[model samples]
Target: MSASRPLEGKVALVAGASSGIGAGIAEALAAAGADVALVARREAELTKVDAAVSAHGVRTLAYVADLADENVPQRAVDAAEAALGPVDILVNNAALARTGPIHDTAPRHWAQAFRLNLDVPFLLSRAVLPGMRERGYGWVVNISSEGSLLQAEWSAPYSITKRALNALTAQIDLENRHLGVRAVGICPGWVRTDLAQSPASLGVPEDELLSPADIADVVLWVVTRPSTVSVGPIIPVRPVSKSAQTVANWELYLREMRSYDTSGGHLIDLYGETR
Candidate 1:
């Protein structure tokens, strides 16, 4: 919105922007001077972020809508465009991760995951594609997860939906390459957010988890690249001792920590922290 900024004159719409990675991405975009529209289900949460983005000297609009609803994605896109102008950047960051064994998972749960993780991105991208093509410039960044690649033991629904979302990214990239519209998937490792604090996180320390801000920085870097260069999917992983497939073992992790400290009086946590 500010005329003198790098992203000045550009507009961005970020879904699931109430907190975590979505909020961080919205803030980063606003700091770069893009008028931002925040979409999430909770008005109260979005209002708080709205205040923060407005402080960056960019117009911020909060649109409360549930991505699970079939019609909400297009409506939210229309509202964002009306408020912030045509969306030059669309960030599909909203996702629902329901963890359970395949046999135990309900049919509704899988449907819900697909709705948020896959359908919303498809619908919203369709809503904005024509405008972006007409202008011959646009960016679509889909926030995927490492779970898409890893074997999800208890998180089958999440894994399946993310894999589908990744496929959608590739399809869009192939189809829109010549039109100046680019799409890419950003897969983040275990991020320390409200969503990550669960029984599955029992052996993991807070310091070992990646922060949403870290993932947001990666997204910002991807979009800020020269328009002439388009990157494919990116996976951002924090430094951790555990295998990508195995659940973290506290004892092993702690032993490694002590060994590093005894050897060099230095220790690195999972998120690349040195102490």
Candidate 2:
């Protein structure tokens, strides 16, 4: 453990770590000196993220599993504990969204969204509580969306589940803050994840949207806060845009895109690198 790293001896389990904000959080936690367990369904991408995390000189475990499955939460938590000791910080960053009016949406799609967005967090929190209670310290950071509060039209399923997730965070905090556990829900307006980079989202200035690192920084900050300063029923993070907004790096971006487009099948090797 390095003296400079506040989280030197802690262990962090990050859901959805194969890419996007999840990968960013895993790497950031490792850099802050926590052993990190990366969880996601893509083994290949998870391997890349694990390698990156290990570069920070902390232990890294890659858990490849679909958290949407009811049986996987316990299995993943058990495996992480076996490999890296008890998890001190749990980041629930995995989620799925289905868009459509409630009446038009398939029941199965709604169920899937709720399972991944809400139930998995609930199960993981339940699994980690006993250990946290015994040890007398733990942090659970739930990644939610602004839709949780906005109730966007045609996004009933995702909005409903995220709202429930925020509520769950409050309930967990109420139940466990007395036991040295801090639970909080973080809802960000728009983040520059893969889904947010679509043509439709590009019209908004990129600088106005949160980046993966932005969210990761928030996670790191939340977990490292002094215990005396209690944090959260729910926290909303809004991106503050820089004064100048322009795509001055478009040439570099296009060159990289061209390189990826021509990099043959090996381009798959770089999925987690950009984020």
Candidate 3:
């Protein structure tokens, strides 16, 4: 295989590939010489990504289905394998981001959040792992969010579901390592997707937000590395010291906690702060 086209002859199945980070990743993989199967509910957007993937002169298939449907994940994988050979890479980039207090959010929304974010990945992994094991090769790249770690306000369902995805990645890696397959969870902070417009990004400057290509570059790095490297189960990608809104909340929390510690001690103080 050529160094410029290290993924030549491989096939990648990417969910939520219609837009944003998914679209970016599908194109990146194709550019690296991998045939890509793009899965998403939006036919129009999916068509656009398919064209882009095809432009790389690699085979491309666009599967239009809502991953929240329990049956759709398997069918998507089945269609991909039939059309482009066995999938060497599976990217679970689909997610349902529900923002609201847990008490106010409907139970159905919570269920959907779990089904799309967590269950879909599990189902897809189950479908592809056996074939990957037989070939002794594969990569499962899960797109979790920074919300999973920060547990930001009014983001219970999103954060909890993504947190579970991290756990799922750890479990999949632990169970499948012997078979020569691996899994990793990618936790990205406010990137320049539609997510950048959310209230959570109140004071963030435009330049501070990561581009979709930024995340895609990381995915390429992850999957292209030797399987023996074990890049760890969770990879957290975030902006450097400039996420305004979330940091503000953290500052508030730290200030309050310091108040409770009445002792004029180092334990109560934030590491970099003079107070």
Reference-based lDDT, each prediction? 0.79, 0.80, 0.82
Question: 2 or 3: which has the higher TM-score?
Answer: 3
**lDDT for each residue of candidate 2 in 35-129, tens digit (9 for 90 to 100):** 99889999999999999999999998999999988689999999999999999999999999665556777899999998999899999999998
Clashing pairs in 2: none
**Superposition TM-score, candidate 1 onto the true structure:** 0.84
**RMSD per model, one decimal:** 8.0, 10.1, 5.8
Question: If candidate 1 were superposed on the true structure by all CA atoms, what would the RMSD be?
Answer: 8.0
Local accuracy of candidate 1 as per-residue lDDT tens digits, 161-214:
888898999999888868899898988766767865442435445666677888
Clashes per model (N, Cα, C within 3 A): 0, 0, 0
lDDT by residue (tens digit), candidate 3, 1-275: 68999899999999999999999999999999999999999999899989989999999999999988858988999999999999999999998876565667799989999899999999999999999989999999999976676633355677789889999999989988778788989888667787445434255567766789999999999999886688868998876755533334433333343333324422111134332
Clashes in predicted model 3:
0
Residue 259, model 3: lDDT of 34
Model 3, runs deviating above 4 Å: 198-201, 244-275
